[model samples]
Target: MIENNNLVERQYEAKNNDLAEEQHEIKKNNFVVDTEERENAIEPILGSELEGLDPSNYPLITPSIELTIKNRFSSWKIAKYYLKEYGRQKGFATKRYRVEFHRNRTVKKRTLTCEKAGKYKPNKTKPIGQQRNKGSKRTDCKCHVNLSSSEHTHYVHITFIYPEHNHTINADNKRFTTAFKHFDKSIMAEIEHAVVYGYCDIHMIRNLLQLKFSDQLFLMQDLSNAIQKIKCDKKVNRSDASHLLKFLLNQQKKEPTIFVQPLINVDSNRLCSIFWMTANQILLWSHYFDVVLHDNISRTNKYNFPLSLFILVDSEGKSRLGAQAFLNNETQESYKWVLQQTLDATSSEPNVFITDMDPAMNAACKNIYENTYYLYCIWHLLQNLPKRLKSKLALIEKYPNTYEYLHNTLYPTQQSWACVFVNRIFTVGMQSTQCIESINALIYKEVSSSLSMINVVEAIDSRMQKEALKCKFYNMEI
Candidate 1:
């Protein structure tokens, strides 16, 4: 019995020894892991210190260091990296330095500045509810860093530094900084193309950008500012009356009879009336002015001026532009000036004048061209017939004689619109002012309402050239 008990005790001791050895092995493995972790944590710090030991190797945070040309070429990325490293060394978050000023194209020089801390406020105003406004009261902290490009060296230099900060930095806020709020290069290129091609409106450009880059977010104000910058850079300003006058003068040099008369506003000394006709136009009018002359006003331009176009029928029965005038008002005085200018340019008067029922135009023609036969556009007279009859439809139904009287009074005779009663001598199968209306439609298609006076003139010139090309092609085929 004693031998068995001794054997059991020996077996228990051996099992206990085996368990102790296993625990010792586990503890040794744990110690190795902990030592490795400690070394790894210290390695980064040691490596950074040794690598950055030289002050010249990285940007200096000290304010005593004088700015040099070496800093002229420094970019925002470099400045940000420097700030982050300097902040890490000072035991503060990097984002505490907020970019405050960035020079756009409006300024002649390139500059960037970063404030030590963001804005802070207190419950200075009246409370709106149960809760009062609360925030850090450190509002006047003056720590900042200013960087500017050296004009002589073209290098970026640290012009100023005030690194001391009052508020604690928040590392959790990872929002993008305002300094980096800029369109990418590709986006700017697209904006330039759009602006150059006349899609310069801010709203239109924004929609275009949205379509092109749906993944990106663009604020309207930012896009406007960017467009303004581009305009400044390209020097694309609105064309004024002086520009128009200069262009006309150039045209007059080419065509001696290109008459331009500017009625100056006595109050502002600005152009109020302008009339022009090229020498070729004058020759064409002299040959074709007798058959039928169609005069109409188009109000599609940006200046809201009454654009008076005088058209004539050519030998081929095609509509040809004779003269154009821009009048400030539809008054008899402005119309007289425009008509007198047209007669003076062409040196001939049309036998038959067809025009809308504008009282001012009628009065002007009667006073200016006494011998010219005046004919009103029947379309204009008929436009009010429906409205006049609509209110008296029941009266017309009750009295057939009343309807006949109204129709006779309105039409009077077919001398105005009817082809059967037309004068075969003067009529080239033309009655209405459809020729001028079609010209206006074509002009409106190529020229926008926002175009300047110079652009309007250019668009008209382009249209005339296209017409000439079409004529040339027809002749070639003949």
Candidate 2:
């Protein structure tokens, strides 16, 4: 199949090459006819016919230089611009045919051809031998200008020009050509601002543009392309981890009350972890700093860095974000660094802490809050119990004290897992990480692995603002 496809492509290219050669022949003939007409028009007037006529009564016949050797420009760019304007005035269109660049990427030569300088080849998607319903604009016209420059010279010179065309030129028809259509930068800026701020109605924008540029041409595709370019330009070019740090820094600038700290690896100089808390988040922590529940969510961004969220329960029994962090790895040291940040932010350790079964996080919690109560999430413990006991049934039967051994193994941490022991603490009826897990679900809806780090930050901020508004509307006690 590949070989057959290659053969078909080669055949198509060969046919196009043949058509180009035939068009060149036609252009050569037209040039010859044009030259002869100019020669005949400028034929020397007979000396006898001019003998009796008064020279003042006849108009002076100077040479025509509009599209000839007399038309010279200071640079190739100026020459191209002149040709474009000339075409617009004469009701025609021009396009770039080819260009050559110097070793340093400077323009060495350029050619501008008529827009209809190529023959149309039917697309292969149509069935073979199908008749066309309409005609194509391509007429193989060979009108063009050649521009070249040399290293020794600073000016661009016109090397050749063929100003004759086989088709008629109409200035009114210029508006219909793609080459003459363009959107103003101011108009595009307005469209981008509107779309970015959530006013994205393409049809309405098109109508406005048409009304504004009544004398010029406007196409729907051009407007669409402009909007798409605006979107593409907003995408971050740096690594997500790097951009994440920059975004936090900027946010700190905008809101001086916000706190942002990043840990960098000394060897690789890459971001190891970052912790940030907004002004509102800090206020929330100040009000409800008694119980802290933190857990890591993975795959929330393209880099797969775990998003660590510290959640606090309000008086209304609602989960609120105290702060957030992104970690490079799940290590004891990383967790300790984050916990220390949270400690500094709140100015004191929580009376009660709850987390999942991760040993690193558990160890970090115990070391940081040595005097505070540290409890394991009951939901996580229940989910892992069946897996741990499914294979231990035979051992329990073989040795009756196998159950006693398991009990002894788990006895030391009974306070962390047993509900009866945890009921003594003032937890607002909360004993698990279910609240944080539910908050994770809401985060997933606002952010995803495909989003850029900057966009991810913006989405998270927007979600928080909405939640805050909802709380205010219902008069929920914070």
TM-score of each: 0.48, 0.51
lDDT tens string, model 1, 1-478?
9999999999999999999999999998788777546644543221132233333334333332233333422344454455544444444433443334334422123332223355664435556675655655344555555655422222234556666666655432111223223576678888988776664455457789989877455655456557656865887656558867776876787567677777888998889978888776788888988855546455556788877788888888788878887778889998888888877777677788887767788789889877786776767667756655555665657556556746765466456556655655475666667677788888777566555676567566656655675676567546
lDDT of 2 by residue, 1-478 (tens): 9999999999999999999999999998788777646644654222222244333322212222256543445455456656776677776878998999888777888888888898987666766567554878888998988887655444565678888898877655554566566555666777777556644344456667668656545555456557556756764144657656766776677688888988898999987788889999999888887888989998787777888989999888889988998888899988999999987776777888888878898888878877778888888887766655655656666455556645764577798888789988888787788999788888787677875555456566756765775665465323
Q: What is the lDDT of residue 220 in candidate 2?
A: 50
Stretches of candidate 2 off by over 4 Å are 1-236, 391-409, 476-478
**C-alpha lDDT score of every prediction, in listed order:** 0.63, 0.73
Error (Å) of candidate 1 at residue 419 is 6.0
lDDT of 2 at 163: 86
> By lDDT, who's the top model here?
2
Best by TM-score: 2
Provide backbone clash counts, one per model: 6, 1
Candidate 1 clashes between residue pairs 3 or more apart in a chain or in different chains: 71-156, 71-157, 72-155, 72-156, 73-155, 73-156
